[model samples]
Target: MTATLIVIGHGMVGHRLVDALRELDRDRRWRVVVLGEEREPAYDRVRLSAYLGGRSRAELSLVAPEFAADPRIDVRSGTPAVHVDRRARTVRTADGDVLRYDALVLATGSRPFVPPVPGRELGNCFVQRTLEDADALRAAVRPGRPAVVVGGGLLGLEAAQGLQLLGMQPHLVEAAPHLMPAQLDVEAAHILQHGADRLGLHLHCGTTVTAVHAGPHGAARSVTLSDGTVLDTDLVVFAAGVRPRDDLPVAPALRLGDRGGYLTDVLCRTSDAHVWAVGECAAVLGRCHGLVAPGYRMAQSVARQLTGRPSEPLDAMDTSTELKLLGVHVATFGRTPGEDGSAIEMTFREGVSRYAKVFLRRDTGALLGGILAGETGSRADLAARVGRPPATDLERVLFPDPSF
Candidate 1:
């Protein structure tokens, strides 16, 4: 008899798990059921900003037509799994349907975090997370009007650029002292800010949004900053951060990590042996990965275990990142500088548009971590070189010839 595997939450990672199972389950050992809360099918959320750039909903879809037509796979869009009966090994949906499963997986992903400031519930305030959120932002776009984007991380910067593409004057508000404080060092952030300035993007760093004041019609008219300054705006887009969606009702409450998310063992199994968790919702080894690559790896790990294959743990997952924000290329990889100041740090810069920094261990000269701003021609090569010594001369690694 074929067993049933019920997957809750149909985001990118959930879809990936189903796809992996389909490829590995050659004997058709298990039937799969996917529950998606959103009405729309799985789409490329990483390229969600492309929606503002004139990409249609169909263009960003990640679901293959053949996968949808698979008889063994059943995908229920717009259906949210409300509760889990661990003892009975069943799932309850919002539509009053109960699903029995031999094994269960939670891939609920996360929800965008909006700070608890006054007037945050105003009419024009939004969060950039799902395709629906993107559609809402696009519908509210008014060219030539001022818009405020909170947070200076990757998502915040991307939202600012998207607003600019929609012909809106975007003012980025970051509580951090500089942009991308978590990823880039001060010098690298300076170079990135210079590039953003050249693009006519307004940045308000070292401050927070105290409150948002409403207009006569009750929409967001202006915002008060922590520095006692108020700026007029048309809308507010909060791309601050995200929290795992781990509040699903379960008979025996699942273990959670210190920060947040379902605490999973090395094999991505939750407290329950029959249950598994993946993606942003699974804090494997008590740590949650926000990047897509790590999430994809976790999904694959779960699928491998279900198919009776050798499953690999996510202990060595790479956390490196590279992206272009406000037309400036930036990348960061490997371990950052240690707090004790043991790692040797080297930096190079030419003009305001370029900067690079690399950290190396004093004893072995092995690469520890590095940051790049402006020209990221060596991102791929340098990221691969992480944890190992440079293949060529140190100077060449830091400052490659532009002619090449």
Candidate 2:
């Protein structure tokens, strides 16, 4: 008898788990059911902004062509899991169907945060997260119209660039003091700010959006900043942040983090042994890492255990991220600043062409973390050195010998 397993999401991380299980579970010991809330199957959400750059829906799809054809896999798109009967090990769907499962995996991912400001519900106000959100933003863009994008992080910067590509006058609003504050140091952020200015993006840092004003026609007209400046805009896009989608029925029974993600053990198991959680919805060791890499590792760990393979605990994870925002290359691998006080920090810069910083153990010279801006060509090589002691001549790597 094959065990029944139900997965509550079909996003990138969820699909990873399914693919891993399918590859390793050659015995066909388990039957899988995937329930996706979106009508469309999983797609490359990381490249969602590319849609504005002429990429189509089909190009962003992450679903394999043979996935739906698998006899052991049952994919129900547009179906959302509404409630979980933990006692009965069953889930109730939106269509009044109850699914019994020997094991349950919650991969619900997250929802983009829209601030509760006045006039937020007005027309042309959007949040960038899913393909649907991207479509809405694309339709809302009016060439030569003014637009304000909330937040200066990666997503917000990407939105601003996308808006610019659509021929809109894009302005970035960041409550923090600098762009990519969490990833880049003050100096690195300064370089990025310069790049944004070159791209013709308006920057409004250190101010929060207090409220959005709407016109009599119910469309967004302007936004009021905390600094008492009113930015006149035809549209507003909020890329502020995201919170895990933990509103399902199973949410109440699971232990959640202070910030609202399902608390799971290293094995990705919730309080219930039969129930597991992964991706953005899961918080391991009380910390929820929103990056895709960590989420992908979590999916692999859970899949290994379910397939009766040697499962290792999710111990240390690399939270590094390398990407180009607004066409400006940026990479933050390892911790920006080492937590230990005994770390030596080095910096290098050259005429806006590059900015690099490295942190090493003061005594052992082990690489801790680093940041690169405008020059990420060595991102892959440097990122691989994180958490490991430097094996090569560190001086030559940061500053190549003139003789060589």
Candidate 3:
């Protein structure tokens, strides 16, 4: 007899779960049903900013025709799983239909966090999340219009750059001392700061938007900063951060982490044995990993468990991040800022701006952490050496042959 497995949310991580299961479940012992809330199928959200650069919706899609054609996998778009009836082993949809399943996986991902500021409901205030949000932003923005992007983190910088590309005067507001406070150290952030300036983005650091005042007809007119400065802008895009989507199913039996997200064990199994959670929606071992890499690992673990395949236990995931912001290559692997005494630090620089920093274990000389800016061609090799001490000398490893 075949078992029914219902997976909620068909985003990248969610879709990967389906892919893993389909690859391993050769006997077709399980029937997979993926439910997505979006009208369109899963798309590459990481490249969401590319929408401003002339990328079409179809180009960013993660789903292929094969997923829809697979007989073992049923892909349901435009339908959201509203509630889960654990007692009856069924899930209720938005149209009031119930789906019976022997196992369920929650991969609802996360939603962009909009700060609670006055007049936030005003028109022309947008978020950088879905394609729909990008479309709305594109339609609302006009050349010469001043736009303020709240937040100076990864997504915030991306939003600012997108607005700039749209011919709007972009202003980046960040409460932190520098941009990408979580990822970059002081020196690297300064380099990125210069890049932002070169891109013509107005930088407002160490300040927060106290309130958003609107003009007539509910359109945003200007934003008041914490420092008592008011900047007139026609649009505002919030890219502060994202919180996990934990409101689904309404299952009282489901456990949530302190900071939100479905609580799960090392196996990605929730309080209920038959139920599991992955991606941004899951809080593994009481902590939620927002990056796609960790979520992908979680999906693999869960898929292996359901397929009765032996897999390694989910442990401390490598949270190293590597991405481009405004055409600048930025990467931080292993540890970003290791204590001075705990680790030996080495630094390298190129003409005025490019930089690379690596931390080695004080006693053992193992790679502990690093930060790279402007150029990061060796990210893959450096990332692989993380945790394990390399046989090569620290100098040789850091400054490897460019040919290799």
Error of 2 at 206 (Å): 0.8
Candidate 3 lDDT over 1-404, as tens digits, reads: 89999999999999999988988898889999999999878898888888876799999988778777889988889999999989888999998889999999999999999999998899999998898898889999889989999999989998888888889999899999999998887788877888888777899999999999989878999999999989999999999999999998565669999999999998888999889999999999888988899989998998899989887867677788888786677898887555658888888766435777888888888888798887544687888888888545654554455576
Model 3 alpha-carbon miss at residue 385, Å: 2.5
How far is each candidate from the true structure, as Cα RMSD in Å? Answer: 1.3, 2.1, 2.1
State the lDDT of candidate 1 residue by residue for 1-404, as single tens digits.
79999999888999999999999999999999999999988888898888987899899898999999999999999999999999999999999999999999999999999999899999999999988899899999999999999999888999999999999999999999999888888889998899889989999999999999999999999999999989999999999989998999999899999999999998899999999999999998899888888889998999999999999777777777888887888888887775577899888888786888888888999988788888645777777787898666765765677788
**Candidate closer to the true structure by TM-score (higher is better), 2 or 3:** 2
**How well does candidate 2 score on lDDT at residue 288?**
81
Q: Which pairs clash (backbone N, Cα, C closer than 3 Å) in model 1?
A: none
Model 3 alpha-carbon miss at residue 260, Å? 0.7
Residue by residue across 1-404, what tens digits does model 2's lDDT show?
89999999999999999989999899999899999999988888888778876799999998787887889999899999999988889999999999999999999999998888888899999998888889888988889989999999988998898889889999899999999887888878887988898888999999999999988888999999999999999899999988898888763488888888888888888888899999999988777877899989999998999999887788677778888776677887776664567788888876675677888877788888888887544677777787788646654565444465
Candidate 2 differs from the real structure by a C-alpha RMSD in angstroms, to one decimal, of 2.1
Instruction: Give the TM-score of each candidate.
Output: 0.97, 0.95, 0.95
Worst 10 residues of 3 by lDDT: 391-400
Query: Per-residue error at 377 for model 2, in Å?
Result: 4.3
